[model samples]
Target chain A: MHSLTRSFLAVALLASVSAAHAHRTWLLPSAAQVDGKDPWVTVDAAVSEDLFELGANALKLDGLSITDPDGGSVQPNQTSTGKYRSSLDLKLAKSGTYRISLVSETAMASYKLNGEMKRWRGNVADLKKEVPAEAEELSVSTTLGRLETFVTAGKPNGTALKPVGSGLELIPLDHPSEFLAGQPARFRLLLDGKPLPGLTVAVVPGGVKYRGVLKETALTTDAKGEFTVNWPTPQMYWINAGYPARVNVPEGQPRPPMPAKRYNYSGTFEVLPQ
Target chain B: MQKRKLLLTAVLASALPALAAELSVKIDIPQLAVAEYHRPYIAMWLEKADGGQVTQLAVWYDQKKKDNGGTKWLKDMRQWWRKGGRDLEVPLDAVTSATRAPGLHALNFAAGKAPLGQLAAGEYTLFVEASREAGGREVVRVPLSWPPKEARSTGSKGQEELGNVTVQLKP
Candidate 1:
């Protein structure tokens, strides 16, 4: 009985680890700020367990979008996907801020059919037609996630920072490219164009391998959906926040109904030394 | 009494020009003994005491590069770039010049001039930042009280990228 209990605990631990600490997706720019008459920035897209160290899997670029300083859609000059990361070059003709993002939306469901558990994933519009009508113990959920970063060719501007009014968004009170070490930077969180309060934001600085410590800082938004981060040093940082924290149920107990939808937002920012 | 008051106003107005101060800045670019050396890019500007406003004084870079390639490295002067340099169009005829050799350089500006003409009478700070291609970066600051109460000098020193930097105010 003791050995069985030990094995059960091990299984529980594994489940929690996989659910809570899944791989993180990010987009890293070659330079957050550039100069000169004609400037171009290269971006790397990847998913890895470690922060900013691209070795796990290349993040697909199908949903890639680039917003120029004028709030107009722009295309990447060149793109390539390798085993570990995807890279793209974007020419910045205008002299202001640009937004690069990977946006995706999908539907996921699980149900018991013929006493066997089945799962399906597809676009939201195909959910009804794909899933069987008589499936038992059916549960469905939708996910919308955005991973983004900002680059400024010359003077930074706010034209490309307007929220899309659908999923989670980060609005910077202080210009992202102007962040300095030991200084506090403010940002507001929104959901569906409205303020999202009391959400926890995880800020992890890059160079985890050299530091040997995660040094992740957790900040909670106030009533106004605003949070501030005091950067520790000059380096690239990843900021992430998600809604609907995972719930753990006891064994032999029926799992509670999961939330119908989930939203996630993450951005990479570079901080300079004072 | 009205005639006397009019005469007093004219006297004060005429004295204003005489009170105008002249600012002289001397910057020293150090010569480094390294395997590879490139002349450092420099940016000079004056900021209000509270750091509210900035007036660019001069920028020394490789103006002769083909297709204006020299401006590409101007961002290496990170502090100046973030403060106000990034927005400026390089090769500005008024304040832009070619890179200088390793020596003491003097720049003089009159109080009633184009760049300093609009400056208000108050405390101000001068910033001189330098960044080299294959070397280090440094910044030197000097403080001044505009329309000087008396002639005075203030300066700062940089260890590696620069040498003695002095600012003189003459009434």
Candidate 2:
């Protein structure tokens, strides 16, 4: 009996350790319910487990699945978080209000019907509600702010242009109309190819305008030398250009011109219907 | 006398779409709904009925947008992204537009030098593809008749806000 008892205790101990290693957690997500407007469900969840051995924020949808009441699974896309993306082909699979079973490495968390799963606009609204109104003022516009965020070691710091790595390189999404009237596209800036750390580094004009109205934005870049913005509306747009600078290393075959005329890169294009 | 002869030649060339060549087509764009007041990127072109490309008509583009001329956004058109948007460093400026409220839009086109009549009579198609920033897309095709029927306008529906899109030629 003593031997049996000891063996049972050992098994329990092993199980507990295995559970602890998952290190999964529910990143804060805001619950929402709106009228005809599509109420979005934004969860800052993270799956930091070795099962998939995904990268730090490998949030793309490989394991995560959502089944609606109609017996169909949901497909997610327009991934603000690139770590894990699912259902990116655009249209949702029409799950019709079902439970979102979030199965992490160790945590088996789930969200009840929560609210109406109308059209999910996981953007603007989600980032606006809980996020500071000031921050919203910054994130809501389609112009680049002066904020630059740096993410290294453990602390994610925000600063101006003083970046840690080489510099910020902006890469835009591949769309048919690179230039459009009112749509918001993406321009990604990287530090040595890898993400700048924080989220995105956007490029925009001095300000933005809407509904025959114009307003200048204030929010600047964080430290990682990154920001996000939508494409300007249909109008003549001219804004100062500035990007995160890189560390001036001395050991390279060649170097760029002094101070780098890249300070305010400028070019122009047109947008008209054919 | 020489100028008069040139004028006559130009008139004859422009009047030929009725004799041999015909123009017909449809344009479609895939749709993805997102949240933003911006319009989708669009691409329009011509394709031979037998699956050969004829020429690129236009690309809905934005000039004031960031990296607007990057040439990368061309891929959003898919078909254009694959066939040409990916490579062509087009000489002309981009053609884009602001987002439209829920509704329909009809358009028209004029004749090209030597016009449709100049081409050898055969089957052809008109293709238009559109991709919005935070909306759905559509690719519409309209079969061109040997001679246009007074530039009739018609369109198909899209999942997102995009409804019917009709393009005809004015007599």
Instruction: Give the number of the best model, judged by lDDT.
Output: 1
Candidate 2, residue A52: how far the Cα is off, in Å? 17
Which residue runs of candidate 1 sit more than 4 Å off their true CA positions?
A1-21, A122-134, A246-256, B1-171
lDDT per residue (tens digit) for residues A1-274 in model 2: 6444334433433333223322322222222111233434443334432111223453444334444334445554443556542212222233123223332221111111232111111223343453433321121111111111111111112121121233333333322123465665344445445554443221223112111112222223345434444454543222223343322223222332222111212112222222
Output per-candidate TM-scores for chain A, rounded to 2 decimals. Answer: 0.87, 0.24
Report every candidate's CA lDDT.
0.81, 0.36
lDDT of 1 at B40: 83
Q: Candidate 1 residues B1-171, lDDT tens each? A: 999999999998768756677888999988664322467889999889875589899999988777998898898788899988999988886689998888899999887785677578778888999877634577888888887777788899987778899998887
| Per-model DockQ | 0.01, 0.01
At residue A101, what lDDT does model 1 achieve? Answer: 94
In model 1 chain A, where is the ten-residue run with the lowest total lDDT?
A12-21
Best-fitting candidate, measured by TM-score? 1
> What local lDDT score does residue A215 receive in model 1, on the 0 to 100 scale?
60
